[model samples]
Target: MKLQAIFVGLVIVALSLFFLSPKVNSLPVGANVTSNTSSNWSAAIPSRTDAGGTITTMVLDAQSQDDGWKGYVGNISGKFTLDDASGYSIYDWSFTVTEGEVYISRAASPSWSTAICANTTIISNEQNYFGMTAAEYDIINKTFNETIHQSFRVGVVDIVNSSCSSAFTYVNDSKYPYINESTPFQEVLLQTGTDLIYAALLETDNEGFHTGYTYDFQAIVPDNRTNGVTTTYYFWAELGT
Candidate 1:
């Protein structure tokens, strides 16, 4: 897989949390639920959605992310509401990410493109970095020059239930955990010993240094360039319960 040398700061947010490894598990017979780097093929849900729960603060756990700046740290935080006969708030929701993905698609309801994933698969710098090892990050950083602003336009991976599948729209899938939606998404690489996180970005202590960004969940996603701008990438997660 070819990668561009462009740099992007860390970014994370709570859109539709949950991801990484693809696996299906048995549940105790109930409705589906939601969850998030939780990327290590592990389905353990450390947190869940509460009544009108909102993760306003975001703090990057330095211990988990000891690699330092490679991607932009962002908070895609939001609440889930049911569209039943009596619009109500969800409760006691469990979180799970079966064979899935979190897409960084176009802003508006746009056509899915393979190139968008490549554009967003960036070489995150001090401003941002994620889901990669420090050594791997250093190699990429050393290889690509900061001034070399270019585009890879490689395309998307062939994941089972990802945006790559033209017919696999989350809004139409009954198994999708969080409040279903119609959005584009974003994928990845080698390195088994490495801490390749595609799940949720664990938050750390505010300790005063990190303010406003102290969110419940966070992750370093691709700064897509399909449209020649990073602002166009939209965060969408697919969950299973």
Candidate 2:
């Protein structure tokens, strides 16, 4: 695989809350609903070509208020225009997301490191695999002349009834347990031949498989000294794996 580098930065609002007082009438099952938030974020990915456009995202967590039909949708979607971008190229993109949540008494930082990985194979097999190690992150930071937070990891948890049938049946296929920064930062490696990004970033499923059980993605990074200060630039995107 050929690796070409282009630096693109994104600002995302993480851990923001929307105050929605429960209504007398609940949202209908399977009905698309949006949160009452005014926050908007923009991110960009450099393509094989030099020209670029805008990538916008609205972050929210939505679900039906029914007990029997409980579901999760990490309501994150992006719009982009990579000029004549070929599907077979690797993109070096960097994104920022606020690292803490606001509360009544005090703000709490993320308990784990979080990332969003693009399951490219779901759209095209020519694009395969996404990988990033601490070493690579170091290089990207130095190359871009930037300082990014190195903390916890956002892992793809097991979904009980993933819309992907095969994935639903074998929910525990990946042996990786959700770990925090006190433990070493393990690398993220997903290959087209074995895994797919179901719905949320940091999630993976058996190659050539998918499910309907969509969800929001997050990791537990805590407010500890050894872990460094929490900040934006807490997210990453990998094209293939």
Could you say which candidate leads in lDDT? 1
lDDT of candidate 2 at residue 80, scale 0 to 100? 21
Mind giving the per-residue lDDT tens digits that candidate 2 earns over 1-241? 1233234444465876535744322111121235532222344543344336856554655533211111122323322222222433233343332221101001122222232332333323312112222353222112222111222222332222211211111123232243332111122222222222222222332221114433223222112122233322123222222
Task: Provide the clash count, candidate 1.
Answer: 44
Q: In candidate 2, which residue ranges exceed 4 Å CA deviation?
A: 1-73, 84-216, 225-233, 239-241
**Global lDDT of each candidate:** 0.29, 0.25
* Residue 53, candidate 2: C-alpha displacement in angstroms: 76
Candidates in order: C-alpha RMSD to true structure: 25.9, 28.8
Candidate 2 Cα RMSD after full superposition onto the native fold (Å) = 28.8
Which 10 consecutive positions of candidate 2 have the poorest summed lDDT?
A: 98-107
| CA RMSD (A), model 1 | 25.9
lDDT, residue 128, candidate 2: 17
lDDT tens digits, residues 123-237, model 1? Answer: 3431143234455543333322222111111113222222221211111213223321222111221111222223221222111113332332322334322334333334444
